[model samples]
Target: MENYPTEIQEAVKIMYEMRGNSEGMMTWKNFPLAKQIITLLDSIPNRSEHHTPYDKIFILNFIIDNISSSDTPRFTIEIMEKELALLKEVLPADLEEYNDPLTAEDIEEELQMWRDYIDTEHFSNEEWCRKYSHYMKFDPIERSEIWEEKYYEIESKIDAELMKEDMPRGLGFCFAYWSSKHKVLAEMGIEWQSPQEMNPGVVFD
Candidate 1:
């Protein structure tokens, strides 16, 4: 696999830490599997505020599709099957039909939401400002420019990755989307075991 950008590495590191790993994994290819597992665990009822009921199932499917198409050595057939089973175990019985495909309109709306939040709520909203008060000390103009640049970089990479799967404009929203999602998942109250936990003795095959 090609080298991942520093921004992606940082995102992956934060996610691993979210799972209680003191040191983030260096292997990038395995990230899709890890991301899928986290989404599955977070989907469980009452697991976390981020729990989207069955919405996580769809996200898992999307991640799996990407993994299947990527030319990476991160996931073996055995590991994939194990992870899928773990995800299925949490599915709610009688899940109502869900067919909300991410459309161009939805992407645009999401992008707008991100932009609005960053430009307004990021520094004005009490909770948001309180949580990120340290960053607030920076010059407003410089800070805004830095954030916009980072968002552009991350979303640009995401756009390229999604393009490879013919999923243009799929997940190129902004930092807010990922940050809120992970913040919610951090509350996954239960001790959700991931596929890596199934074979703790091995790092990766």
Candidate 2:
């Protein structure tokens, strides 16, 4: 809360109170989708208040709008596809600037970590999973029938339950929102890539 900017802080403050608590409870859940986003946007540390930069605002707004919206169901496939594209489009591009070849071992480790990424974290979920997959790989078959079914099944369990309108989901997911938050340890200059949990069916090479 202390890290938040003034305007965003104001909005969150109002919303917090509106929901009857600082934690913004709804239906026995933690801060509701609208409140979560309101808190997140409000938390952005910026020069001014609600007037955050375009990219930042765009990112947050995209997340807030969709997550809390009841409209995605109207055209779940189309909306999911579009949101997936938008997420990839907006993801930070700094990772590709790696200094050297990503060796087979490196690939293997990354793949495992990617799989481990499925482990539920603070705020991350399927939406974050799909979006991250989109940005980290090339020509990913995100629209596969399997993915479609998975998305349908997952989305069916959600509706207007996001923290914000449609900014994004998984804000708390191991640094899903902040690119530098819970960085991959190996990539952060701490250690070499390590193998992920062993699975015979999975191969890095």
Best by lDDT: 1
Top model by TM-score, which number?
1
Q: Poorest 10 consecutive residues of model 2 by lDDT?
A: 190-199
Report model 2's TM-score to 2 decimal places: 0.19
**Model 2 lDDT, full chain set:** 0.35
Clashes of 1: 0
What are the clash counts of all predictions, listed in order? Answer: 0, 24
Q: What stretches of model 1 exceed 4 Å from their correct place?
A: 1-53, 68-70, 73-79, 86-94, 100-205
lDDT of each: 0.38, 0.35
* Tens-digit lDDT track of model 2 for 34-98: 44554565455433442323333333333333332221222223333333343343323422433
Candidate 2 residue runs with Cα over 4 Å from true position? 1-5, 14-205
lDDT by residue for model 1 (47-97), tens: 233333344444434343433212221232333343344444444441445
* lDDT measured at residue 67 in model 2 versus the true structure, 0 to 100: 37
Q: Candidate 2: lDDT of 44?
A: 54
